[model samples]
Every structure is written in structure tokens, then in C-alpha cells.
Target: MRLLLENKQFRIFWIAGVFSDLALITYFTVHGWLALQVSDSAFWVGATSGAGGLSLTMFSVFGGVLVDRFGRRSLVLVGLLIRFVIALALVALIMTENIALWHVLLAAFGEGLAVSFLMPAMMALTLDVAGRGKLLSATAARFAGMTVAGIIAPLAAGSIVNSAGIEWAYVMIALGFSASAGFMLILRPPNPAKRTNSSPLEDLKQGVTYVIRTPQIRMLIAMIFITEAFGWAHESMLPVMARDVLHVGATGLGYLLAAGSAGATVTTVIISNMGDIRNKSNMLVGGCIGFGFFLVLFAWSQWLLLSLAFLAGAYAAVIVYETTINTLLQTSVPDELRGRVLSFQAMMWGVTGLAGFHTGAIASAVGAPVAIAIGGGVVILNSLRIARHRSQLDPDLAQSSLDSESIDSRGDQPES
Candidate 1:
């Protein structure tokens, strides 16, 4: 922790990310709620989120090529500024009583598309500042920071919405993004170690090809997409679940979110203290299985308190699964290809939106609880498939492959 503070670059990078994440969380919290208000349908709410995810997905590869071709700082700045401006516009629309569902969709699309650049640059830049030796610890610290932020953000957002109205929540989102852009403008993060000189289209093709040819990356991505497609719609499902399934109001929804973050925060602190993990693959598998199980439990529980506890445990498992996957990928991937590679990870997030719609449709047909249970079951199936690939990875490679990231100036032994 002291090392994170002592490393000026990591401190600035982490702080900037915290602000951006806070803004994003606040925005989405309000955004989904608003979508529900306007349409009164879970499917529409999911579709609203899907619009943004679609934008992010469509633009991620381009964002990657640009980040690798150009510099990180500039792209990060552009992305932040774009979102800040969108937030401001949203504020205007809300204030003038002119806000509509289309306005929400417009704002979502702009923020989502712009953020594709910011998210990859953020991760790639963190690796640059920390380098390989401190990368895992720094990444753990980063997640811990975000977890802390997540814990506070929902309760705070709930208060603002409860006392001042949802309009004020969007105002907070604007301020948070503005502050993030200001702080980012103060940092001196590194550029990619290897820059692409090819056409953007050709570079994108190569990035795709590279991910395919790398078995570890390929297998990991397959797992991620499966989880994403079946498992990642919980946020979109939250408002409906809170209102219909649990009879919890907005404030109750906020408490549930905070409870989940509390669990994630505890797990992150544990990981940060552990330093280099030896049984990371096992932890990753266990995390997925735990997450899936808890989600099913949460779905089945009728009592709000019990459901909240299960939800908290579910998020804790997700944090463990996600943090491990990120550390492994970042440590193992080449600095040159890092931007492009991380972009694919961003695409996993994009997949979540489409999955959100699928779940929402199910909820519309039946109910949110059943949809959530089905999603969890699907995740467990995918986890089993991910486990199957482990046998082919060689026990030594499975255990110590983290060291491969440091082998050369390139990175992670390039698949085969």
C-alpha cells in the first residue's frame, strides 16, 4: 500500500481511475433507474444498456489500434472530455425538463463509445508505470481502490436521489468526470513500448489473429465471453429485482449494492496482502464456481436480508475471478500488444450488454429471479469448460506461467 502511494505514477493513475469509475457508477445507477421509469419494462431498461454496450463493442478494436498507434495520455483525455461533455448535456436536458428516453440513449452511446479508448489506455498505462515486477500488486491495489469507491458510491447516489431527486445524481456524475479529466491532465503516463505502424484496419486484423493464435488468451477469452453472455446482466436486472422481486425501493437497492461492494472490498484487501499468488488458476476457478453458486442462492432467497448476503458473496467471488484474470492477462501479454489485447477484454464488457437484454427478455417473460438463476447455471457450465482446458496447459506452465511475462523485452512467451 505504501509502495502504491510512493509510486507517484500509480497514485495519480489510481486516483484518476477512481473518479472515473465513481462517475460511471453513478451515471449507470441513475441511467437504468430512469430507463425503467420511462418504459416501465425490464427489457427496455436492458436495451438502453445494450445500446451503450453495442457502441463500446463496435469501437473497441479501433480504440485499441489508436491507443497503440498514438499515445495513451491523449486518448485518455479525449475519452474523459467526451464523457464529461455528455454528462453536462444530460444535466442540461434534465434541468430543462426536456429529458427523454432518446436523450438517455444518446448519452449512453456517446459515453460508451468514448470510454472504449479510455479503459484500455488506463490498464495499459498502469502496466507501463508499475512495470512487470510490481504489476500484480499494483493491479490488486487498483481493484481495492475501486472496491472502496464502489462501496461509497451507491449509498451516496441513493442519498442524492432520495433527497434531491435523480437529476442531482447526474450532476454528481458530471462533477466526478470533470474532476477525473482534471486529474488525468496532471499525469505523465508512458506510451506503448511497441507502436503499430500499419493501417488501423490491418492492425485490428492482426490483433484479432494474435488473440486467436494464443491458447491461454484464447481459452481465457472464451470463458469470459461465456460468463459475459450468460452471467453479466445482474446490474441491468437489479432495479427490476429490487422493485418487483424483493419489494426494495431505491434506497434498499442502494444498500444491496453497497453490501455487494463490501464483500468485494474484503476480498480485494485479502488479495492485496497476498502479494504474488501461487495457486491463481485454482483461485480463478473457485471464484467462478463460488460466484455462480451465490448468484443461484441469491435468486432463490425470498427474504431481502438473506438475498443481500448471497448477493454480497456473489460479487466477492466475481471480484476474485476478475482480478485474477486481469493480473494474469496483463502480466503475460506483450507491452506492444497490450492495448489491443485489453481491448478484447473490454469487448467482454460489451458482451454483457447483449446478455443483459437476453436476461431482461427472460425476466419480462417470467421473472427476474428465474432469469438470474438460469444465468448462474450457465456460468457454472462455462466454468467447467474453462477447467477442462487446464489439463492441456501443463502443471508447471499452469502454476508458474506468470513468470513468463518477464522472460524478454517482448512478453509472456507468445502462446506457442
Candidate 2:
């Protein structure tokens, strides 16, 4: 609250996130609905979503290198502009009635490529705009902004798809992307780390090595990968649950999605207000467990109201864990490594996408409920594994990794 009110640059950045995330959220909602409409198969729906994830996996590391060399602001601007173009293309396709599964798959892949650059830069820029001391609040506030988008985007996109047509929904997405880019045009965060003479490949190698060797980062990345693969993968099956299981249409799906966003909005706002706190690891683990538990409940739910309640709980728990991890990772690393380290985090979305594809196939084989429940179960077991290895989450271990084999000129091993 104070941060947004006090920092002009961060305020602009936050506003841009709202519109950018709105575009993203709307695109996903509409994409799932459109995929279902065109193919009428769960496997194809997951494939479409997975295509984007594949793009993210392939290009995100490069995006990180670009961010370090070029600048975060420029990448963010370019990414949003690319998404705006993609949205326009989708609009044209839908309007011409030439929409097909391949078109959706291609669009999702393109969108993911753009986001690969946009997200790492955006998150790295947040630390610069708000300063290290305020990373948690800034991140939580940013999530809150996205939650606002989440609450509005689904309902609005759903209504547009139901009433005016899918083309109009895409028009809204394009406009949102453009609007976000416009807000970004005015933002001037601090410059990225001083460009070293090191080649981009060298920079990338250093970043990956740093994450691999640093115990906290290594473990955190692994933890998030598991969470994304198993827990978040359930997202692709959401439409299946909404339509086949819940027997709901587009409008009903909108409410179902919006319910989760509403829950996230509340959670993010509260976290934004709380400021940074200690024992973040405990909170992170607890949130992960809660997210899995709620997701399982949501999967098994037969009643719409019960499903909404569980979904909301799942989203709320996700916000806590996700925000905490973002804060932890941002605060743990130096400014120069920020973009690269965060890039690995962004790559997790790719895992989520690919995992969603598998989850969808599983859903087809067993059932949506069973598939989702299985994913949720995996998350529970993974988080429990982390809970037992508490020392891996310690910030001291990250500091030790940084200080010992510093990426500095000396490369001297600092004494423990």
C-alpha cells in the first residue's frame, strides 16, 4: 500500500502488470474454451496449452541472457508488443472463421515465447524499482495487481465470448496488452547490472551453475518444478471439470475461474499489506501443502458451490507459496544474477504446461477428478519431502554459496 502510494516508478510498473496479466489471464481462459470448441477433446486442449510451455522451455534461458545484456524494460516492452500482435492475429482468425486447433496451438506457442522474455524481465525489474529491502511487498503488490486482472479478465472475457463472440474476447485481450505496453512506456526502472565483457553464453553458464551449486536456490527450483508439474498441471483440466463433470457452459466456467481469482485477490492484498516476515520457509511449505489439499478437494467435489470453495482455497494457498518463493529468491541473489536465477523460475511455467498435457491425457484415461487428485497427491508428497529437509531452504546456505564461489573477478572461496 505504502509502496504503491509512495513510489511513482513502481506504481507505473504495478499498473502495467495489472493490464499485462489481464491480457494473459483472458488469453488462457479463452484459449481453453476455444480449444474445447474446436477439437472437442481433452488431449488436444492440453496439447495446445503444452505448445506454449514448450516454447517457454526452449527460449526462456535465452530471454534471461537477453535481459542481462540488453535491459529488462526493453524486453518487457517487446514481449507485450508481441503479445498484442498475437492477440490481433487471433482476432482476425476468429473473425474470418478460420480458427482451428493448429491456429490455437501456434498462437499459444507464440504467446509463451513472448512471455518467456516478458516475465523474467518484469520480475527482475521489480527488485530494481522497489529496491531489495522492499522485494516482498513489491512482489505481493504485483501479484495483487494480477489478482485484480484475474478477477475481471475471466468474467469479462467469458461474457464477451458468450455474447459478442470469441473474436471480441480476443479484441479485449489485444487492447489489454496494448494498454499495458502503454503504461510500460513511462516506466524507467534502474538500469540492469553493468554489462560485463563476458559473452552471453558465459553469462548463462554462470547463472545456471550458480543456481545448481547454491543449495537454497537449487532446492527451491526443484521444489517449484514439482509443484508446477503436479499441482499447477491441474489447471488444464479445469475446463473438463467445468463442462463434463460440472456440466457448465462458458458463463459457468467464467464464474468458476473468477472464484479462484477472487480468492487470490484477497490473499494477495493481505500479503501485500503484511510486508516481509521471517520464517518464510514455514509459510511456503504450509501453503504448498494447503494448495495440494484444496486442489484434491476441488477435484473430488460434485457440487458447484463446493467446487468453487475448494478452487478458491487452492488459489489462495498458491498465492502464499508463490509470493513467498518469489520473495525468497529475489532477496537471496545479487542484482546481477537476479534475471537469470528468476529465469529458471519462469521456466517452471513451461513445466506446468507440459505437465498439463500429461495431466490431460491422464484425465482422458481415468477421469478429470482422478487425474487432478493424483497430481494433487504428488504435490503433497513433494512438499512433505521439503519439510523434512528444512536446512535446504535456509538463506544462510545461499549466502554461503554466493560468498564462497563469488561470480566476482577474484572467484576466491570465502572461508566458512
Candidate 3:
């Protein structure tokens, strides 16, 4: 917590992140609503979401390469600027009554492209500003910021859409992005990324090879993809579960989601204060298992209160798992490869988006509860399987073999 006040660079960056994240949350909320207006079909809503996810999937690696090659702060500012433009463009379309389905899709895709750059560069830059020592606390703080944004952004966007107009909602979004960029302009990293002569393709190849060959990284990436595909995918079916299974309407759905956010907030505060934990891998393992167990409980619970409690527990477990894994990965890698490595996590977001489609399909065949239970079952099984090789998840390798390997591969001096 002191890190926020003691470190000026990180303070600025964190504020910028909060604002940017708020805008992003608002965009997603507004994007769906606007999609419904332009085309009332659920299929079009899915397609609009898919457009963003597809863009993220296709361009994340290239964004990582750019992050490693250019100034990370500069990249973040650029990404924010692009998003600001996109938001204003939407405002114009909405105001002039010229908006179409294609316009919405294009804006979604553009936002995705902007995020591809924003996420990797911002991730790498976190270590740059905060240093590896405070990585976990800094990450927790960022998550806390996101949790705050998640709560506020939707409500604000919803209010604007209801009162003023959709165009005004977008106007608010544009203001948020511009405010973020303003904060970013003043941020200065402790160590700026050095320009590289390596081709983007070559850099991308090296990053892929490094993750594939490194056991710790390979295991972490695999776990993330599996969890996202099977476990997090169930999020798409929440509406169905609320209506059909729990007999809760839209208002109840909001409460259920709010419960998850509340749980995340509590966990984030605890982690932020913990400083550093030695056995992060053990925590990660436990978190994954807990996440699955809670999901199953939530699926089976007929009572809305019990389901909310279970959902909250699941979200808390995920916060633990994600914060631990992100800290481990950041501290493990050399500075040069950090962006590239973190991009893999960005890629997992894309997987979650795609997995929603499959999860929805399964829910169509079986009931939503059964489908979600199956997803949770898969998460538990995969976590157990990986738990057998605890050594690979160990952080000792981060200070020892992995550091040596990263240095040898990149020919960069180790961080002090």
C-alpha cells in the first residue's frame, strides 16, 4: 500500500491504468448495448464481441514485439490515443444517426487492436516503474483498480445511456481515455526499453520458442489456457443460469456479479498488504482447486444467496491464482523478454472469448447448470494433474535456472 505513495512513477502509471481500465469497462458495456440497438440478434452481439477477441488473438504477438522494440510508455500513450479516437468516432456516428452494425464491429475491432498494444506494454512497464521487488503488490493494486473500475464503469455508462444518450456515453468514454493519456504523459520508467534491430517476426519467434522450451513458463501458460477455456468460459452462461436455474431476473444477475466483485476487492486488499509470499506456487495450486470447487458449488446451488457466495469464492480464488502467476512470470523473466512473455497471458483473454461460444453450445444441449458443472469439473481435473509436478510451479527456478536461461537467450544483464 505504501508503494502507491512512495513511488511517484508507479503512482502516475497506476492512476493512468485505473482511468484506462474504466474506459475499457465502459466500452464493453456500451458496446453490447449499442450492438443490441443496431441489431437485436444475440448472434450479432456475439459476433461483435468475437470481432474484438479475434483482433486480440491475431495481433497480440506483434504488439509484444513492438513493446520490446519501442518505448513502453510511448506505446501505452499511443494505444490510449487510438482508443480515444475510436470513442470519439463512435460518438460522431451515434450523434449523426449514421451508426450501423459494421460501424460497431469496426469500433470493437479497433478497440481490440488498441488493447493488444496497451496490455503488453503496460504489463512490462509495470515492472519498469515499480521494479520486480514490488511486482505482486503493484499487481494487486492494479487489480484493485480494475475492481473499482468494474463497479463504476458499468453503472456510469448505463446511467448515461438511460438519461442522456448513447453518444453521451461514448463522450464520457473518450474523456476517460484522454484523462488516462494525460497521466501517462508524465510517467517515467526507471528503465526504458532499449530499441532493437531484430525484425518483429524474429522477436516473435524467439518469444514463442522461449515459452515453449521453458518448463515453468510452459506449465503456467498451459494452466491459464485450460482454466480460461473450461472454467472462465462458464461466465457466458451466467444469464441463463440466473433466469432458468436460480429463477433470478436481470436485477439478481447484477447482484450475483456484484458479489464476485466484492470478493475480489477483499482479496486484492489482502494480497496488496501481504508484501511477498515465499510459496506462491502452493497458493496458486490451492487457488485453482478452490476456484473449481466453488464453481461447482455455485452451479448446484438453487438458492441465489448460496450461489452468490459460491461465485464470490470462485472470484476470490482466481484473484489469488492470477496475482501469484503474474508475479512469478514477471520476476522470472529478463526485462527484454517480459513484454513478450506477458503477451501470452493476453492471448489467454482471447481464448476465454472463444471458449464462451463452445460453453454456450454445451449449455444449449445440457442445462446451463450441468454445462457449468462440467466446465468446473474439467478445471479441477486439470489442476490436479498439474499439481503432480509441483516442482515446475516452484519459484526457485525464477531466481536460478530460469534467470540463467533468460540471460543466455537474450544476452542481457540480470536485474539487480
Candidate 4:
């Protein structure tokens, strides 16, 4: 904790990140509920959610390039500024009672675009500030913040919506975004490394090639894509499922979502306290399998109590896998290359989520249970295959390779 306090920039960044994320969660939860109220169709709600994913899929590559070229601080400021303007526009529209479904869709898409840039830039900044020795702690701190926001934002938004109106929820989110922008404006991060003449396209290609050539990173990325496509996609459908199948209202769904957040918070605290444990590779493998198993349990559950329990378990497993994989990436990759690599990872996640949303939509047409069950089964099968190849997929391989390269560099020098 003292170490974290020493990094003022990181604290500022964390504040900005948390507030922005709070706004985002509040907006999306309320927006989805409002869309359901307006159209009374699950398909449109899914499409609204998919629009955000599609924006991330399309723009993430460019966002990464901007981060590498212009530096993390500048890109973050720009992204937050854009979000501020977007939020203000949304607020104005709501205040005048002139909002429409298309208006909400456009706002969601714009926010998604901002996120494509903001996420990679923030990640790059975290690595720069925390450096190698504290990467795990830094990651744990960020995840803890997110978990807390996830718990608070949805429930708060639900209460506001129930008591006042959806417009009030939008106003609250706008205030959060505006405050986030203010905090971001005060942060001044370290300067990025200078580049000679590298084109953005070449940089993107290089990042992609590196990930492809790195066996562990490749396998990890593949696992994330597949796991998120199946197990994670169910998140967008939760509101609909709660309403239609479980016969629960918005507030109940919010409580269920909070349960997942509580689970994530607990796991993050455990990881933070444990520090770096041995057998991380084996732990990752086991966590992935556990994630899939709990997802299956969540899908098959009919009782609300059982579903919440399964979701909590699933959430914990995913958080562990995510934090471990991200720590490995940040510690292993060189500073100059971090932004581009993270961007690629973000892109993969976005595209997979887009596919998963469409799959969920199709499943809704048949039945929500059928869709979630199939998704869970596929994830379990894929995780099993990955577990069997644990030796090759171990994320520690990257760190070991970096150490070996350092040794080789030292050996090639003349005697002092």
C-alpha cells in the first residue's frame, strides 16, 4: 500500500479509470433496461450491446497505434475529452425529452470508440508507472477498483431509475464522466520513447507477428477469445433472462450482478494478499477449467439462488485467469511494444464478444437456456483441450524467454 501511494500518477489514473468505468456501467445497465422498455424485444437490446463491441473491434488497432506514437498520457486525455463531450450531448438530449433509440445507439457507439483508445492507453500507462517489480500489485489494484465499481454502479442506477426515471440515471452517469475527465486532465505521465520512421501499419503488423510467434501468448489469446465468446457472452443476456425466464425485475437482476461483483472482489483481495505464488502456469490451467465448469453450472441453474452461487464462482475464476494473464503480459513485454500488444489483445476480446452476442441473439430465438447451455458446454470442452496442452500454454514461458535473452545479450559482450 505504501508502494502504491508513492506513485501519484497511478493514483490519479486509478481515480479517472474508476469513475469513467462507473459511468460506463451505469449508462449501459440503464440503457439496456430502457431499450427493453421501449422495444420490448430482446434482439434490439442485444444489438445495442453488440454495437459497442463492434466499435471496439473496428477501431482498436488504430487506437493502439495512436498510443504508441503519441504517448499514453496524450491519448488518454483525448479519449476522456471525447467521452466528456459525448456525455454532455447525451445529457442535453435527455433533458429536452428528445432522446430516441437511435440516439442511445449512437451514444453507445461513441463511448465504445472512446474505450478502444482509452483502455490500451491506460494499460500502457499502468505498466510505465508501476514498472516490473510491482506489476502484479498494480493489476490487483485496478481489478479491485473495477470490482467495486461493478458492485456499486448497477445497484445505484437501478435505484435511481426506479425512484426517479431513466433520465435521472443518465444525468448521474454524465456527472461521473465529467468528473473523470477532470481528474484525467490533472495527470501528467512520463514521455513515451521516440520512434524514427515506423509506419502505423508496420507497427500493427509487428505486434500481430510477435503475438503469433510467441506460443504462450498465442494460446492465451486463443483461450480468451473462445472462453469469452461462450462463457462471457451470457452477460449481455442476463437482463433479458432475468425478466423473461426468471421472472425477476430490474432490481433483482442488479442484485444478481452485484453478487458476481462481490465474488470478483473477494478473489482480487486473495490474490493481492497472496502476492506471486508458485506454479502460476498450473494455477492458470486449473482456473480456466474451473471457470468453464461454473459457467456450465450457471447455465443449467433454474433457481435464482443456485444461479447466483454459480455466477459468483464463475466470476472469481475468470478474474483470477484475467489478472494472472495480464500480469504476465505486462512483465514480459518491452515498454515500447506494450501498447500495440495490449491493443491486439483488446481487439481479439472485442471481436469474440461481437460473435458471442450474435450467438446469444440466435439462442434467444430458440431459448435462452439452450443458448447458455450450449455456450457453457463448448467452453468446458475447449478448456479441457487447453489444459491437456498446459506445458506449451504456460504464460511463464515468456518471462523465461526474456530472461534468457538478457543473459545472451550479456554473454555476447567483451570482458570488462
Model 3 clashing residue pairs (backbone): none
Give the CA lDDT, 0 to 100, for residue 393 in model 1: 30
Q: Estimate each model's TM-score.
A: 0.93, 0.94, 0.87, 0.89
Question: In terms of TM-score, which candidate is strongest?
Answer: 2
Instruction: Give lDDT: candidate 1, residue 97.
Output: 85
Sorted on TM-score, highest at the top, how do the candidates line up?
2, 1, 4, 3
Q: For model 2, state the Cα shift of residue 40 in Å.
A: 0.4
Please tell me which predicted candidate would have the highest lDDT against the true structure: 2
Clash pairs, candidate 1, are: none
Ranking by lDDT: 2, 3, 1, 4
Tens-digit lDDT track for model 3 on 188-276?
A: 78788888888888899999999999998998989998898888876656656655778764445556666776777788889999998
Lowest lDDT block of 10, candidate 1: 391-400
Question: How would you encode candidate 1's per-residue C-alpha lDDT over 1-416 as one tens digit per residue?
Answer: 56576789778888888898888878767788888877788998888888888888898888888778887877888988898888888778877888898987777778779878888888888788777767767777888888787878888988888899888888888888888888888888755445656788898898899999988888777778877777777778888888888888777778778888889889888887777776567777888988888989988887899988998899899888888888777776777788899999888888887677788899899888999899899898778777766633333355465466556536635667
Off by over 4 Å in 3: 36-43, 95-98, 162-167, 237-254, 300-307, 363-371, 397-416
Q: Give candidate 2 misplaced runs (Cα > 4 Å).
A: 396-416
Candidate 2 lDDT (Cα, whole model)? Answer: 0.88
